[model samples]
Target: MKFYKKITEKSKSNSLVVLVSEDTDSINFSNDSVNLLFSESLSNEDLSSLGKITVLHTPDSLYKNFNFLRIICIGVGSLEEIDSNKIRRAAGSFGRYFLDSKLSNLSFFVDSIKSKDTDLITESFFEGFFLGNYIFDKYKSKKSEKKDVFFEVVSSEISNIQDIVNKSYEKSEAEKFARDLVNEPANVLTPTELSNIANNKTDKSISCKILSKEECAKLGMNAFLGVSQGSIEEPKLIHLSYKPLKNENSYWYIGKAITFDSGGLSLKPSGSMFSMKGDMGGSAAVIAAINAIANLKLKVNIDVLCLATENMPSGSAQRPSDVVRAMNGTYIEVENTDAEGRLTLADAITYAKGFDPKFIIDIATLTGAASIGLGKGNISAFSNNKDFMDKVKLAGDITGDFVWQLPLDSTSKKQNNSTVADIKNTGGRLAGTITAAHFINHFVEEVPWVHLDIAANSMTSSNDGWHNRGATGIPTRLLIELAYIFEK
Candidate 1:
């Protein structure tokens, strides 16, 4: 989709558009652009009413009646209430409607945002709109129609912010790549295949390297390799590094790349294994963010590390009462193989520690407790650094990729105490997410680090935001946006 800025004026071509909160009865447009409004009369008298538009409100399906090529609308609400998130959702609604109706080309009126600056609403909307067009249908036989969209803003101020928007879109594309990898069936995206994808799709400007199981074993990545021993596919320690033009600062990103987690010999019930394809979401996200940053040529040094493996039930699979050593020379007791994400991540984080980065952020679908704690729309974060976590919170506020901080204090750490190894892989049954963070903290080596447990937000069970059906690509924008602040 192409995005542009055009002076607010009447159009000469036919288009279909949605007027979010316009009063259609009082529309006074002098141009050919048909405005469909979701009036106070049409909207529900509640909070949920914000993004709701009904067929009865517009009288005509704007797509059906508008011979003109685009439909435009203004989202009417108080500035305090009409936030960036609302703008993003409105954009998603616009894009989904356009694609469902099979409208080939359309543009929106960003000037119509009543309270916020046109640039903010316009950028937020496009981010959501473009994301809505995202799909992971690589293996599907039937596919949805593609959409080409353009956002026309009325101010030159937009040009200054256009780079940010483009970067956001680029980040989303990288995230989509990750989402596709996560959504792919386990049959195709094994540990070895995932390493190949990472090697091939890596930015040319960056350096890529992979450590095979033999190499990892030599370096004592037994914790990560133990989980992979069950699979016929080879396990890989995936590493990619991006060195900017000027070496000013460096951050390490670590991800858990479990290809197909069947809980190893401990085993998950049949129903619980349904979405295990998304087990590698964290690794995908880390690589995606790195790719975007490198592509945008951000002048910040970075390391992308992934511990890729599969946890399956087989003769050789690691089992309960097993002890394995990590790359950092720490031993782990495999109390429950179901808690395998952290094991892979431990080795990756331990490996990244050798680079002596200023900070490290490790992401993974590490715990179901994360979903239970933060739900499906929010990320569960645990960090020892307050300043870094504050930046993340602010970034989430701006990008609408919400993340809530969880505790990782002594109480949380105590839950992970192990009699046999340095720490237990599973943190007792309660506050599971926080304990998981505590477990990862054991390997971060006191660097200004944060753990993002993306079990809930990485992919959605339904369509919301700009995501269509499968992967939400949550926080990809937030991570990239936060990097800009750190780099500055």
Candidate 2:
């Protein structure tokens, strides 16, 4: 997909057309382009009723006289409702249309919206369209191939906004990289393969370091390595850093990268294990968000940490009574090997503490309790610091990530009382998510920290507004926004 600021009328002869209902400063539809109307033919009342889109397609044989065959009218729900997200949805709707119709090329005209500043909206649509086309196709023979996509901005003066347009595309590219990594089968994307992806992609702006099993043992990451011992694939503790030349305050983000969660000795049924490939989604989100910040050259210092491993059952797997030392030197009694995300997060959080960052935010598909609590609607946030959590909430609000802060210092903390070791892995059935967070909280100690239990929101079993099924990539934009907040 390529995005250009201004496409001349000559460019329209060979392409399918997309037109906006109205004309604006930065986008102007050529006469040859399809006219996207708000209503049946683009009336004021029709625009109000058309909440999302109105599309048309012609027979393949009549491709001449302008292949203006396919016309998609996107509804802004009146001029007042037009925003970046709506524009993004407009893009997604376009992608879905192309997939359904098997169309090859699309030329979009950005002149419809009333906003004079069409630059950001145009760019955002392209980004959203490209991202919405994402599918985990590694195992499928009927994989969808990339089609030629063109976004043509109709204004001559807004060409300088190409930077934002290009940045959005770059962000999408990094997101796709993370998506691909998350979608790969567990056999192919072992801890070793994860480290290789980091090594191959790092540059001066982003520096990556990988610690193998032996190195992890040397660093006292026993709790993390204990879970990895059951698998043939070794565990990797990954640290990826991005620093700007003028950064003032640095922040670190930790991702729990459980490549595959098999419930260890307490094995999961075939249904649960099938989608376990996405267990690494938290790791993917952090890396993808950091990759976006680096690509945009945001003036901030950010470190991304991923504890990559697979949780399986074997003779070598840790038992329920086993106690292992963490990187922070805390002893953890393994009550259930299936409760492994917090163990890996403990090591990653301990490692991140080395940098003495201003703040730490850790993301993970930590527990099913989160789903039980939120019901796949919103993310649960637990924070030790109120001000920092407020800042994070503001960021989420701005980016539309939508997080709800749940109490961490609830009765769940008392429920984690372990008589044998420092702390127990699982705390009964009630408030399981909060108790798991308390378990990880032991490692975060004095730092201003926020933990996002995204188990419910990170991936969906069915299609729901704005987000379809599979990895939601829930909080990437929120993380990016948080980085910006800390930079200031």
Candidate 3:
């Protein structure tokens, strides 16, 4: 999707989108018949009911006078309730409209809405439209033969919307990149393949290094390696660094990139194992967020790291009751082989802490309890530092990626205590999300850290809001917004 915010007279898209609020009365057009239709339509029915869309097709005779072939009016609630998210979801439906209607392009025009916050409305429109125009038909024999889509936010009310559109495009495209990676089949997106993708995408501002199994073993990443021991495919510890010319602060982002989670010896049922390909959603988000940060040229230093592996059931696989040593010298007793993401994260976080980052934030699809607790669209966050978490929460809210903070009580930590090792992988059925977080926290040492349990929101089953079904690309925009917080 090409987002050209300002459309010139010579470059007019065939389809036009008009936003309707309670305050909207008449939709003005140079054509008298077009104005007449809208005026009569408004008198007969209210077009401002939130989420109500009224589409009108041009007749054959009016084709000469009709500047646009089709006009779609999207009602965006009352002016008081108007926000970015509503605009985002509504604008996002354009993708479906484009595919179904076979429309080449769309020009967005909002009425008196310009008197309010035009810039934010502009940003939300582009972000939503950009993000929503996604389709994962990689495996389909007959893929969508979609040409370049032209999206122009034709706002006479604002002059600076073009830059916002460009920025939102880059951000949304980064998320789309991650979504494409997460949606890939496990056979195609192995640990080695994911590492190569990371290495190939590194720009001049960023440097990427892939650590092999032998190197990881030398670094004492046995806990991470132990998870991949079941599979013939090799594991990788990918470290990507983005340092500004004038570095201000240091930050670390670690992700659990389980290319496929077969539950090791404690295998998952067939029904539950199908979507396990998305186990690497966290790592995809990390890579995507860092790419956006670099593309935006954010002046901050960040370490984007991933522990990529696959947890399969085999004779050599790490069995239940297996004790693995972390890079930080912490011992973990794996009572359930299904709880493998934290083992990789345990070793990865331990390795990241050695860099003495200002704060470490690790994201993973660590537990099913997260889905049970938060349902499908919210991210369950646990953090040791309140102030950093507060900033993270604000970022999530700003980007329309909802975040809820869960308590990190010392009481929950007790559930992870083990008889043989320092801690156990699973903390029983109760407080399962918190226990998984607590297990990852055990490796954080004294460094301030936040753990984002993205299990629930990682891969959405449907195309809702700005995301289209698989791989909601959780926290990609949130991470980009986080860089803004520090930039300020």
Candidate 4:
């Protein structure tokens, strides 16, 4: 899509989108041609619903005068209640309308919105519109044809709109890249393939390294290796580092890169295993965030670690009673092979501590209980440091990738107690998310850390505002925003 910042009178597109406040009872349009069509529709339709889209087809004679085939008016709630996130959702609905109608050229008029900062409003709108246009049809034998959309943002005040547009475009593109990775089938996007993709990133400031199984074994990462033994494909431990010219305190982001999880020897039902391809959603988010951070030239030292492996069931798979030692010299007893995400993360977080990071954050599609607790919209977060976790929550609020904090008290810690080993992989059925985070906390030790259980937010069955039906790329933007905050 080609995005432009220009006056509404100068738009030469076939469609024009105007933002209307839900509190406003009457319709207002700057374009005479649009006013004539919209006024007619206003008399016949009720647009009191927020984010509701109403389309008005222009008369044959007026099309040439207005240079538009139709006018779409989207409601933006009360002006007092309007925020960047609301604007994003409204714009997303507008974008979806355009896609459904197969409209190629469109212009957005935000001149009606005068209460908010023009730059912020325009950027939010563009972010939502661009994200809403995302579609994953790679495997479709008969793909639907989509035209190159010509998008224009019309505003009287144009300062910083272009810069905002550029930045939002870059960030959203990075998010789309992550979504693509998550949407790929397990057959295509194996652990080795994921590592190769990370290695192929040609950013000069970013360096990529892939550790083979032999290297992992040499480093004593048996816990991570244990999860990989079942799969025929070799596991890859991916490390991507970004060093800025002026470095400050460094941080580590670890992602559980289970490319395809079949629950190992424990095994999952066929129904539950359908979307196991997205087991690496956390890894996708980290990789995408690193790509965006490098592209944006954020002057912060950061390291991304992905424990890439597939948890499959086979003759050589780790048994239920197996005990594996982690890189940090902690023994973990495997009570359930299905709780494999934490096993990989335990060793990865242990390795992350070697960097002596100021803070460590690990994201994983770790538990179904997390989804059961918080539903699919919010990420379940547990952090050892309150201040750092608050910063992360703030970042989530800013990015509209919400995170709800779950307790990690001493009571939850008792759930992981193991008689034979230091801790058990699974902490039974109760407080699954909390116990999982508690298990990882053992590896983090003194270094402040946050664990995000993204199982619910990774993929969605329904469209939610900026997110489409498939891979939502939940916390990629949150991580990028947090990186900027930490850098400051």
Q: What is the TM-score of each candidate against the true structure?
A: 0.87, 0.87, 0.94, 0.93
Task: Write candidate 2's Cα lDDT for 1-488 as tens digits.
Answer: 44454444444423434435343212223433322321335543343232355555543454344445555555545445566666676666555655656566666655455464476566667666666666676787887776664444444445555575666677666666666777788889888888888777777789888888899888888888988989988889889988885545568888889999998997888888888888888888888888888877788889899989999999998787799888887888888889999989988888888888889999998888888888775788999999999988987765556688888765778887789988878887888988988988888998999999888777766644345557667777678768778767
Strongest candidate by lDDT: 4
Q: Which tens-of-lDDT digit does each residue in 430-476 have in candidate 3?
A: 99999998888778867889989988888887778788888888878
What are the clash counts of all predictions, listed in order? 12, 3, 0, 0
TM-score of candidate 1 relative to the true fold: 0.87
lDDT of 4 at 43: 66
Judging by TM-score, tell me the better candidate of 1 and 4: 4
Error of 3 at 104 (Å): 1.0
Q: How well does model 2 score by local distance difference test?
A: 0.74
Runs of candidate 3 exceeding 4 Å displacement: 1-8, 58-66, 110-112, 247-249
Evaluated at residue 430, the lDDT of candidate 3 is 95
Considering summed lDDT, which 10 consecutive residues are worst modelled in model 4? 1-10
Model-by-model lDDT, in order? 0.73, 0.74, 0.84, 0.84
Candidate 1 local lDDT, 1-488, one digit each (tens) = 34444434444333424344432233333333233232343354322245553332222354344334333443434555666688778667655666677455554434344454655565676677777666665666887655454443333335655565676578667767777777889999888888888898875788899998899998888888888988888898888988874655578878778888899999999998989988888888877888888888887788888888889989988989899888887888889999988888788777777777788888888888887877877789989899988988887887887888987778778878899888889877899998888888888867899888888887677787677788666667777777777778
Please tell me which predicted candidate would have the highest TM-score against the true structure: 3
